[model samples]
Target: MNSFFARRYVITGIFITLAFVLLARLFYIQIIDDRYMLFAKNNVVRTQIQYPARGVILDRNGKLLVDNQPVYDVMVTPKAVKPFDTVEFCKLLDIDKPTFDKYFDKAEKYSPSQRSIFQGQLDSTINAKLGERIAEFPGFELVLRSVRSYPDSIAGQFLGYIGQANDATIAKSNGYYHPGDYVGISGVEKSYETELRGQRGVQNILVDSRGREKGRFANGMYDTAAVAGERLKSSLDSRIQKLGEQLMRNKVGSIVAIEPSTGEILCFVSSPTYNPNLMVGREHGNNYMDLLRSPNNPLLVRPIQARYPPGSSFKPLSALIALQEGVITPQTTYNCPGYYVAGNRRVPCFHNERHGTVNLASAVAESCNGYFDMVFERLINRTGPKNTDTSFTSWRTNVAKFGLGAKLDLDLPGETGGLLPKASLYDKWYGRGGWRSSTVISLGIGQGELEATPLQLANIEATIANHGFFYKPHLIKAIGEKQVVKAEFTQKNYVGIEPQYFEPVIDGMQAVVDRGTAVGSRIPGIVMCGKTGTAQIRHQDNSVFVAFAPRDNPKIAIAVVVEGGGQGARWAAPIASFIVEKYLRDSITRRPSGIEPGYFMNASVLPQPAKPKPAPVKAKPDSTAKPAQAALTAGKHKKKKQPVVYAAAILKGDDDE
Candidate 1:
């Protein structure tokens, strides 16, 4: 009897201990561990993401360039969905029943209990029309969002466009972005994405069965407010940008104009551009595909992407380099015998004109081929052929100081460094000991492997205009309402060349617009300085020009390229001149007779359907020609008789090569 009572007592003691441990665990789970509580809360609470408004982009003058318009995304938690009028819902959303079914199935497959986008990017009109009736459909909610809207349909390439986040972008966002979020694809939108895309928030709302919202969950204790993106104040001048687009209409090229003192891009125009608005809204994908498929390659950001041999426009920089190396001086003179002949190779000058005994300034003003060729030869061989690579590297290094052969780190996307041929490139082509200065003599006149984008060329002119120093070329002047200029852009970058060396080059550029090749493009009172170049291509040469205005305390520096536009003086020079006049004076007072509004605006250089050749007529010799025709005929060698306004088969195909 004693043994039985002892066994009973031991069993009772063990049971009490077990009960105490179980009670302790229950208390810990109910009070200390929030994970289970949160999991339970998820059933009664709906967490809605609050997407903030993307920042507005404005011109330097405070004109709105980019704005936002409210849109909605119809979200659904499929498990809570009940039988509703599918036909009525489909009709209200303007979607066919099959399409609605497809979307519903996709969302249901993605998640049954969690919400996912059913239909996205519905405009405010649809939001207003559908919001009132959304209560009829269980598990459906209209979540507010914003889409980019371009007020002025300009700067399509510069402003870039936005699209839904891809897998790569979402992964990069570190869980911040989901499948339905929008992200910048290119241009300023891309470069400033972090600043332009604001902080996303979340709100927990109490919901009953069927996923109908009752009110804020627990008095909105778990809610976080969304922060709007910081505003971007772009350096672009809208009026000038619009004018540049008009001037570049139907042409295949780019124009980049910058303020010399600040390095602010005034106008960035890439021709054959589409309306930025086309990159927004429901038609975005189709419109983007069309632009992508266009033969003109309108999507190309030509200012920073299109690399071309700068041709004669490179003479000024060459002159500066030669002067800096003490191989040439202001008084240095070289006679051009029509061609730069080094053994069997000959680089011909413009029209192969013989410029007799020209100084550094005159050589640049005349775009003298032999003069710069000899200068480059002396520059390369000054240290001797044994050190050819060293000298070439020195030259390359100097060019880089002026923002060549390297990215400018501009406030936009896809800026190519342009090609600055390294000694290794030549060393690979010809055995190290097998070549001398003569082997790469073509680089003297900015041909062969030397390539620069319109932006780099414009920046080179800006560097020269600033007298041997330049601020990094940029598109955004400030950020946010405080208008904070980036410290990187404010720092001055000085080219190794002394300021004194730039004087002769500047004088020659002044003469180029005043009495030299670009004389016809001279602005009357603006004291513009410029250089004209014809970069050789397979089918038709590309016309190129670079310029800066007012000579002293320069405000604007510009570069223009016109593919198949013939001579630089005829097309590119005048285009640059018109842009300068518009920027400085704010009015184009000196429109050339047939070139300004009619020719530049209407002319198309892209290939068109061939028309029957006009029947040849007997040649008549008459001295009389219109000012426009005379301008073409007055040059040393007459241009081929292509129509002034339009031509067929002009693009006969050459890529930027």
Candidate 2:
């Protein structure tokens, strides 16, 4: 009996002590631990993403190039989503049940503390369906987003394209980006991505038991106000771009036109171009895949990326370098027997037909291979292992002045550093191996290893156009009043080829348009000085023409190349002429006869001329028109009339574009 009583007393003591401790803990929870209470309430609260608008892109003339449109995405948090109408839900969203489940599983991969979207950029029909059925499905929600669109799609390549950020992009962007964000991929858009992306905003909302938002947490102070991206004023001319694209149909090469004084690229075209619209929104992946696999390589930016032999286009630099070094004079003479015989071998000229006697100016006018061959050999022999070579260094210096084998700073994405040989490079290449001067003589006729980008070639023409100086080509005009987005010119390659040298070269080039090989491209009143080049590039022949018109005060400098072109004058020269005429004169009348409109190749520019001539009202199909047709017709410009505009120009995919 005594033992039983002792046990009862111990049990009561233990029970009373435990009850008191429980009471104390309850009081602590009610009064001391505010953290748990706050956390419990936060269980239902959420922060939402607020997407800031992307920047608009405009041309120098203030035309809109890129814009954004509203879009939506439907997503489900697996834990939050409840079951009902599984088949109907899948069908409504145009997805299979398995896909829905797959996305739900993917969403669970993220931490439970933060919310993330599953599907993105829902179509309008699905968005409408989601809106009507969203209230019925508890955890299902729609994320509001935006899609990029190009209204005109004119500068597809120049403006580039933007798409959702991938793993690589997210990794590189740091805090500035998330997986679903868009990024610029090429051209000006990629160059100014940060300025165009803008700052994103976030909103946190407080909700009750039924998932209705009650009010802001701490007066919404943690929220961010979305900031818009800055607009860019570009240096693109829409009309000029259109005309150039029209002329480049069925062509494989590039055309780069620059404003000589400003270096603003008027039109930079790579043939077989694609529509810019093909790269935006849901259709991008498909189009991108197709473009990549196509043998044509639509993605290649030929003007800046392709490095090809400058061919005869380089002879001008050689001639100028020789003149600058006093290796030759404008009055220098060379004897030709149709080929240059050095040592024991003869390097053949264009024909068995001999250009019997030639001077520096006449040599250039005639593109006499014999004259350049002698000059090259003389310069080489004067510079080397045998002779005192103060003039040899001058030879390389003068060529460098013409920007050979160097990259010119430009706004475009890819600019190739074209190849020009150096003594050291030759030493490293062939110096130790007994590579002799004979091995490099072909460079004299612009045929050896020297290469240049179309962009650099255009700049070279501008150099001649300006009589010595040239500016670096650029694309963007400005960002706003705060920034003048100009490209700076570097003098690293400036040859210091004096105006005295340029004067004679200009005369030879002028003769090219007036009476020589390029006579078919003659614009009657325009004193266009140009050089035509035919280079054997891989399996195809590349015809290139570089020119600057109104030779005295050049307004435009253009470089054009046509792959598989048989001769420099046939296709390349005419193309260069048309571009110049379109940009400067604003019309062309010289056809097959050099007397009539023939058939207007670029038909859309003018309607039809009243006198059965080229311009169209029934406007004259004047290729080079004044800024205004009336202004041109009112002036000294005349037109030949009445012709079929699209006779042979049955270009595909062009008319619709």
Candidate 3:
């Protein structure tokens, strides 16, 4: 009996211990560990992301260049979807049956419980219509989003476009972006993406099983408000930008204009350009494909991407370097017999005039290849009998000070530093000691291996305008209202050459517009210092011109390049002059042949449709004709032949040297 009682006591102890352990676990789950409670709450609570409106981009004058337009996206949760009128839904969305099927399949593949975009970028009108009847649709919901809209469809490449972010972008966004988020693809939009894409907020709300919000989860206590992106005031002048585009409408080239004192970009134009609006909305993919296939490559940002020899335009920099090195002076003279002869190779000057004895200023005005060639040889061979690598390196360094052979680090992307051949390149081409100044005399005239982008060329002109110092070239003038530009842009960048060396070179450039090759392009009442370059290429010579206007206290500096456009004076020079006139004088005074000044002044981003041919003077119908009969006769008349849409003409030839 005693043994039985002990066993009963042991059994009772075990029961009590199990009971305590169960109670402890229950207490830990209900109070100590809140994870399970939160998990239960998550089933009833829904979190929604609030996307902020992107910033507005404006020209310097506060003209709206890019703004946000309210667009709606039809979102779907596949699991919540129920069978409904497929035909009616397709009709409302204005999509075909096949398109609806495609979107539905894509969303189902993405997720069954999570929301995904079904139809995105619907205009306000369609969105309003859809919202009125949205209650009938079970699984779909309307989500508000903003898409870019342009007031003026100019500066396509400069302004860029926004597109839906890909998986890679989302992965790198650190949880900031989702698959459907829009991001800038290129241009200023891409360069300033961080500043332009504002902070996103979130709202947690109580929801029923049907996914309809009941109310804020915690009376809005956990909700975060979205912040709008900062506004960007660009340095672009819309008027000048329009003019540049008009001038380059039918050509393949680029134009870059800047304010020399501030490094503010006035206008950036790439030829064969399309309207920025073409890349907006749902049709972007199709339009982008068309642009990609274009033979003229309208999408190329030529000002910073395309590189070419500067041709005669490089003479001013060469002269400045020569002066700084004490190899040449304003009075230093060189005799030219039409060409400079070095052993078996002869570099000929375009001008046949003997130019018996030419000084620095005269040589620049005449673009005397022979004179610059001689000066370059003297500068390189100055160190006794051997042309040391150090001399070439120093020469290249001076050239770099002008923003050559290195990227200018402009605010835009895809900039190239341009090609500045090194001594090692020569050593590889010819044995180290075998190559000398005579072997690369072509470089003195801005040919051979020397290459420069249009932006670099323009900055060189601006540097000259600033008298040996320049600010970094930039497109943005200010950020938000109170914020100024970055300190780096404001800081002065000085070339190695001294300020005094610019006077003679400036005088030479003045002569170029006053009476030289580019005399025809000079603006009236403006002291424009300019240089014309005909860069030799595989095709037609690329016409190039670089200039800064009002030689004293210059304001506007510009560079223009027309691929395969023969002489700089004939094409690029005139365009630069027009840009200067429009910027400073606010109107063009001189119009090139066959082009009216008003054509540029009143240019539109979209081509103006040709007016219908005047109706033929048909014999008047009988006065008794009925109104319906007359309308029928008018409609029956064959429509006038539609005017041919003009495309950018592709010119082919070799570059002039």
Candidate with best TM-score = 1
Off-target runs (Cα >4 Å) in candidate 2 are: 1-45, 75-79, 84-86, 97-107, 110-113, 136-140, 209-211, 215-219, 385-398, 422-433, 481-483, 487-494, 591-657
TM-score of each: 0.91, 0.80, 0.88
Q: Which candidate, 1 or 3, has the higher lDDT?
A: 1
Instruction: Give the Cα lDDT of each candidate.
Output: 0.82, 0.69, 0.81
Considering every candidate listed, which one attains the maximal lDDT?
1
Alpha carbon lDDT at 455, candidate 1: 94
Can you write out model 1's per-residue Cα lDDT over 1-657, one digit (the tens) per residue?
999999999999999999999999988999898888988888788788889999999999999999999878899889888899999899888899999989999888877877888888886677788999998998888888898999999999999999888879988879887767888999899999999999998899897764567999979988999999999999999989999999888888999999999999999999878899998876788999999999879999999999988988888999998888898889988877777765344655666677878999988787888888898889889989899899989988887888889998888878788999898877785667556777677678887678999999999999999998899899998999899889999989999888888888999999887778777776777798888888764345788999998899999999999987766776788788888988888887743333454566776666343345434333213212222212222222233444543221111110111
Q: What lDDT score goes with residue 622 in model 3?
A: 24
Better of 1 and 2 by lDDT: 1
Error of 1 at 103 (Å): 2.3
lDDT of 3 by residue, 211-298 (tens): 7889998898999999988899999999999888888887778899989999999999998788999887777789999999987788
lDDT of 2: 0.69
Taking the tens digit of each residue's C-alpha lDDT, what string does model 2 give over 1-657? 999999999999999999999999888887898777868757756777787777887766788878888888665655666668888888887889899878777667753334566677777877897789887877778878766778776766677888777768888877567645677888787888888878888787887876777787667888887887877877777766766676666666788888888777877888767788888655578999999996657788888887877877777777877787688888899887777764344566653347778887777666777788788877877756443133444566667666667777576666678887666655564444334445555667776567888888898898888877887778877875575554353332344877878998888888766666676677867889988776644334567788898887899999988775545665667778877887786676563424222222332222122233444432233212222222222222222222322323211010000
In model 1, the number of clashes is 0
